[model samples]
Target chain A: MRARDVVITGLGTAVAGAGGPETLLRGPVAGGDDPVTRLRGPGLRYKDRATRLALCAARDALADAGLPEALDAPEGTEGGGGPLVDGLRFGVVVSTNWGNVDTVCETSATIHRAGYTATSPMLLPNTASNVTASWVAITHGLRGANVTLCNGPTSGLDAVHWARTLIAAGRLDHALVIGVEPVNEPVRRLVGTGGPGLFDGAVSLVAEAAPAAAARGARPLARVGPYARRADPDAAVAAVRADEPAAPARWYVPEGRPAGGDTGPAGLPAHDLSLRWGRSSGALGVLQCVAGTAELARTGQAAALASAGGEGDDGAAALLLLAATAAGAGA
Target chain B: MNVLVTGMGAVSSVGGDARATFAALAQGRSGLAELRGFDRSRFRARHAYEIDDRPAPGTDVPLRATGWLLRAVAEALADAGLAGDLTGVPVLVGTTLRELRSVELNWCEGAPFDAARLHFGTALRERFGADRTYTVANACSASLYALGLGTDLLETGEADTVVVAGVDTITESTYGLLDRVYREAPESVRPFDRGRRGMLQGDGAAAVVLRRGPGAPAGARAYATVRGVGLNCDAYHPSAPDSGSIGRVMREAHRRAGIKPADVDLVLLHGTGTPLNDEAEARALGEVFAGVPRPPRMTAVKSMIGHTAGASGLHSLITAVQALHSGRVPPTLGLDEPIDEVAGFRLAREPVTERGMSLAQVDSFGFGGLNAVAVVEKVS
Candidate 1:
């Protein structure tokens, strides 16, 4: 594949696990305990649980991106107000695996009580599938085009595909694509009986336009790899089981080896940097969306994105977001 | 008129199936009457298209508004003469209300009722046997949004012959809210009228099959070639669209379709008849079409059918397709006094002759400013 210049510029996150990206890199949030829970905020009343998670992530992401603080009403209100929001070319594309459970429950209740008209007018707008993206725009004063992709659990990566395609097509100068899922009673019950999709949170990444990232003297973080990858089930099981026989004290290899990975010099295409997700697989796939950018923010470039193994058919997802071959690990 | 409309569906108060529902709509019959879906005994004036008397399993769900959607989808596919496995085709559905009716079942009823499971995508996939199902929920404009996305998917080679369906039955929750607002001002919904009170709740679904490349049904032609679609968020309000942005979507659609405002023959307006909505729409239409001599002859079908929420745009598009097919544009259903805002627009009160051969445009704005506008051209 030809060299493609891509850099992460903005970040936002709202995780059920207590830690933000800073702590997230150090260790996994799930100590294999009960489900993690995010805080309930004033944002809940105006929007549903799913939306609350999205906003929380967007708040952190924008701040991490080093963009100006956001004003509730307007930017430049230095009267103890937040910094300026990001640019207009910054488009928004978010993915959600299960956004409707809460709203569905709400609408269902209205139907049961006084018929369908029993629904709240205030709540109707936010329940729509695209409301998450639209609300993001309204909250942050983003007027750019928005796209919300709902693809089962592949929502996060689907959002990446949409944003990356748009960027490659020169649609937006810079784009903020996010993946968010919120925990609610109905959804919790549904997932609890499920074989997968155990957790919920939001992760956003910035795909800076060529000029914008370069103008800021920002180095290219990682290659968006040719094809996005989802982990193989059998391989995942092996990784988890092999952990038992590993050295008791030594930390596992941060670099995940490809199945039948070549036995070569420690110079594999993605043979660098440490990758850590508190929870392995399943819900951890979501972290790929965040980790790719987080690594970029810290190491200026992470060699590869990996989903942890060992968890049940908890489908792990990873993309090789490696840096350009300037350090000599390329074709 | 080459654009072929092979299938159709609807779920409204009068009748859930397409044939029965469309007949009622053509006759200008109101679906709003009594409230049975929910315990609306407390409201001042209880009026809604409460879908009671569930249609038979294959017929229509009697007590459920979504039941109409179920029946409608069947009739629509049947009309198109497509019933066997639809495993290969993609499904693009626009819905403002989905198991939203289920919301009440969980919160108000304690836990989710068994009935809610029927509307889930997994169930729909099994029922319809489609390979893909992209459920779009975009408030009132959902149907149009689904259609818009379908057009893009087709253009991008994502799928061929995508089935676009949009439906929503006025749930007890939604109607109760409407009753409260309508109580503030009691009046019939009169689009483009000076005394517009607010929007009314209507239940229904509309389905359109879009085929790509040269492989349409034999001898069947497209009723309208979906040239371009413009979708945007107002970012101005939760339940309303931004006039300025709406104006841009109109421009962008035309630009993408390689046409100009002067080329439009008809403007299918999403006239919910609510004062705020009508005013905002009028202002947006005026701003967008100010350059044209007279705005495209604006006709609203919702005036006759009520606000169909998610399926409104698809219904409007179907009406446009029929108009293009018959060489006549239908008149507005209910318009008493013209709103001062729609000054430059021609509110068609009676069926009019088709003026241009080029194309027609339809607008559908959902709650939260989720807007969708599509350019439909006469099949060559």
Candidate 2:
């Protein structure tokens, strides 16, 4: 199938000490304090730490997109103003490997220690991964289909790809794609300590259809190119390359992995997002995609983002092409 | 785009395979029994629809749920006539409690737990040689969402064949949460009934093999064609049902399928047996069919298997397809009093065998108000 034209209009991220899209590009800040204080709101206190982290990133993304702050108004209320986009047309997709694992363990402990009756009813929502995305939707009044994906590391990219598909299919006009992984004692003890690094927080991007975005006069950060996922990284890359013969100026590949042996005909320079941003289970792909979009918008250089597939990786290999300007304009 | 279901499988308390499960459903077999698998001494809800026996030829993976999923997948593969070597096929798994046993066992055994237990997709990939694996954790409706994703993959030509499954085991956390949050009848689940108290946790796994486009071989019969999928968020409360979203999703599924409410021959209600959920769903169905000539025949599968969590959606879908195939609507297991029935809709109390059911609709409402609906048509 031919790929449709989709654009990335906004980006928001909260990783390590970084708090927004701009901070994300510059890399993590020191101290690694959580942004809960900055992102607190009415219903946020009841949410788990992971959900709070995602909520902060999601709020930032909507704000960056120039959407109406009224979207954040509580349900059944009009605190802020009119909504920016039609609630039904706007959707959210969040990817997390171990969604709110911390809360799950805590609930289990409560059940064991104090008995089931002592467990908080409020904590029940946090145990599921979809609540992470649901909180964003509920807070933003996004009535569009909210989806939660758990495809390991590739979850972020897969989410982006799915969002792009929904827009291309005309199912949604705007989609919010986020990848989050919150640091918790339970996950650390399970996965074992030590890797390149572990960062908590989330990365969110706003994908909008060309016509809808143009109608709103939203400046495009980058035009999305052909995207594909396959078992073989080489095949996936080749298929994407075949769609866009022009080599990108730069490539953002996952750390510790290469895009097969070929660097395309141009042998474009490649950078590792994992090494630069530190390593974590989920949100790696979203971080790289966001970083690639940033580079394209700043330098007007076409960038290619590739994530190699692992044996058990939920996401196989995804080749996302981004251009500062539109790549297709055939009358 | 039309996606065909070439194969299907199930591992539930009622039966081991899809056929057996359907047979039991048709015969009105109730899987609800005393919760023997776990020590429910402290819990008020002592009875559940639990899978007591281990999967035949179980492994040492420490997670019974994972083993159940494997067995269901193998059965689905064999049913689809593609058993051996699933090298590059994309596999999508939807579940609520993924590998809960692994965590519980590890926590019980004390410190130094394997972190890999946290990643269910990776664990599934390692066990089953699927080139790509996707784990959907969107609560009760997760498996339905996975089915929708599989449909998207096929429609986009991303993959020729995709395997989608939903599996969830009875875990203490799930039981505890249900007991604490939505306590009704502590021992049984009676969906859509006036006496419906609350849902009983059920252990089950279900799988379906989807192929892109139309025209399966004449020899290999397709169960049904997945015509349209609708997904939407309530954006209301975390655990509360959003009647507006629920109605919209059902309408959206019909709209996507290029059909009206009248085209649906049957409706598989999410029907969790919770008072709020049942009332909301009933209201949504009424609003959706207010303009239709007649409402579809509706029944709740959870009445038989209890609430299967993530697998609940697929479990309902499987039952709907079988209902369409066999020209019968299985009785809703304890739905003697139909309090939530809408006008023009027939709630199944006895097995209703009506031929020529071309279209069926299945509803799945996950926790956090995640609503998903699928419209499937029999493709003869």
Candidate 3:
């Protein structure tokens, strides 16, 4: 069977200091209720900050996609009386670099300083790296393929590609692709607070087959385009642009790595999200996609490209996002 | 678009390489011993399945798991007959406590460690000149998830050859958590046993070189054909395995493989030996193979190697593939009285040699109810 075209139907954000996706453009704003508090229902006691932020973003994305029944359902009901979507066919792919590091570091410290007796059994489940993704699945009743990508800088884009792959393989019809990073004491100790600070929350996108979205009457924000991963910035850009009829109207480059010279398309306007939102690590790629969707909605642009590569990164990844109106035009 | 396992490598408590590990399993050699990597006086369970021949720590690779991964990758590449520069081949690593031990050392012992080593991409790039690497942390089911991703890459024509690996080392944090969770740790892992205690931690790394069958070199050795992989989340509990989800995933695997449940010759059970896990798995198996004239015989390598955390899936896969080739099913050591749920099922208590085994299924379920099942067929 031929691969199906994947479209982004909904977007959500639980970013610190930013009220909404539109607020992301104006740069970081301070002071707001804790993102964790944005989550509803039980199962919050033992969850780490990353998982809570992911739940918030996931809830928003599902609601934005017009699938609020997935959230409104009673606890344990996969999807409560939803005619539009089936929770069983929905999956989740989460990308995070230092996910739950705070829990891990603290738990280890507790075991080290006060011995094993001092540790709490409730907090032990949070130490697993995939805990955040699992919580997102459990909370929302996404019973399909659940995967967590902890790959370095490009993980967010990788998560997007993985969702597409699953859809094309008929594993799931829809997926919540989330990119989250929590900046806390453990993160500060690990990377140090020097460069482009740390991103404190999460961003998510609801990706599904174009036909599925159309059947559900959901508006497509953008259609996923070609993706490429290469060892260097130039090759990655060139490969993603190889089959495109025209260069992307705008580009979203990796954090701390500005677009210039060979790193980006020559004349296209480039935006570095980290400059305003801090270094999101694994979340940068998805954040860039969200920004691209916003640009498409704002200016009616034809296409946009989001590229990721950073210091100590093994390779670079580039993903193209075509405007929804141009979805029929083959790349 | 056939995904073939062209090469295999493993380093575990039982042995340092895939061949040796399989031999040890067949010989009923147990790798369990007193846990010596860290101070075990405080914990009630002092025993674990740990590798004895650990390489000396290097400044470049501070994390012990990274060394095991590199060694496993080397063996896999060599086994696949692909030597020298692996420039464009993508590497996918699955792990649970990736470099967390290093973090523990740094935080607790004031050891100098670079946080960049937390992910395996940098180390892989430095060692193999790999252009792209993905580190998946799907808990214990991580490696099978990576395998599924690699299969997608192959089937989608993304990459001709992909290296999928899973590696983990015993860390104080995980050990302490399990030690605390289990009221009394069994001296040995006894999967599917009536008196099974809880699971013990293990340290290991395993890798497989997957290639598009048509593109593989003529006469290249193919261990098994990856027919299909089924992945799902129970979305139920944080630490408990849901039998319904397990049964569903197994059926999904069979569906994707275009085969029936009865086609599977041998089943490599997740069989963590934890009361909840073994019971749930047995129930799932019973439901999945309810109508089959002859149910597939099952074995749990963890009964011998202990639970290797994220690496357990790949360890089980490598063992299953080896069993497919050798026709010798490894024993699930320390299982004397079988669990009631597995009453009629043939649980390999001793090494059994049977010819003409063509298909095998491997099951791996992890914390947070992450489940991954793979169906592999013997390649002629």
Best by TM-score: 3
Clashes of each: 59, 2, 0
How does candidate 1 fare on TM-score? Answer: 0.76
TM-score per candidate, chains pooled: 0.76, 0.92, 0.96
Model 2 residue A7 CA deviation (Å) reads 0.7
Give the Å error, residue A255, model 1.
22
- Worst lDDT window (10 residues) for model 3 chain B? B53-62
**Tens digits of lDDT, candidate 3, A1-331:** 0238898888889986877776666776667766777666765777888888888888888888777545326544565725556666788999998887887778778876777887788876787899988888887788888889887888899889889988887878899999999988878888777766888889999998877787778888888888877788778888888899856888888778744333345667778888788888889888888778877867778899888985457778989998887745222
Docking class of 1: acceptable
Error of 2 at B143 (Å): 1.7
lDDT of 3 at B349: 83
Question: Can you write out model 3's per-residue Cα lDDT over B91-177, one digit (the tens) per residue?
Answer: 889898888878777766767878767888888888988877888988888999888888988887888999999999877777888
Q: Write the per-residue lDDT of candidate 2 for residues B42-95, one digit (tens) a residue.
A: 567778998877433322235668777887888888888885456678788888
In candidate 1 the C-alpha lDDT for residue B79 amounts to 65
C-alpha lDDT score of every prediction, in listed order: 0.58, 0.76, 0.84
lDDT of 2: 0.76
What lDDT score is found at residue B248 in candidate 2? 90
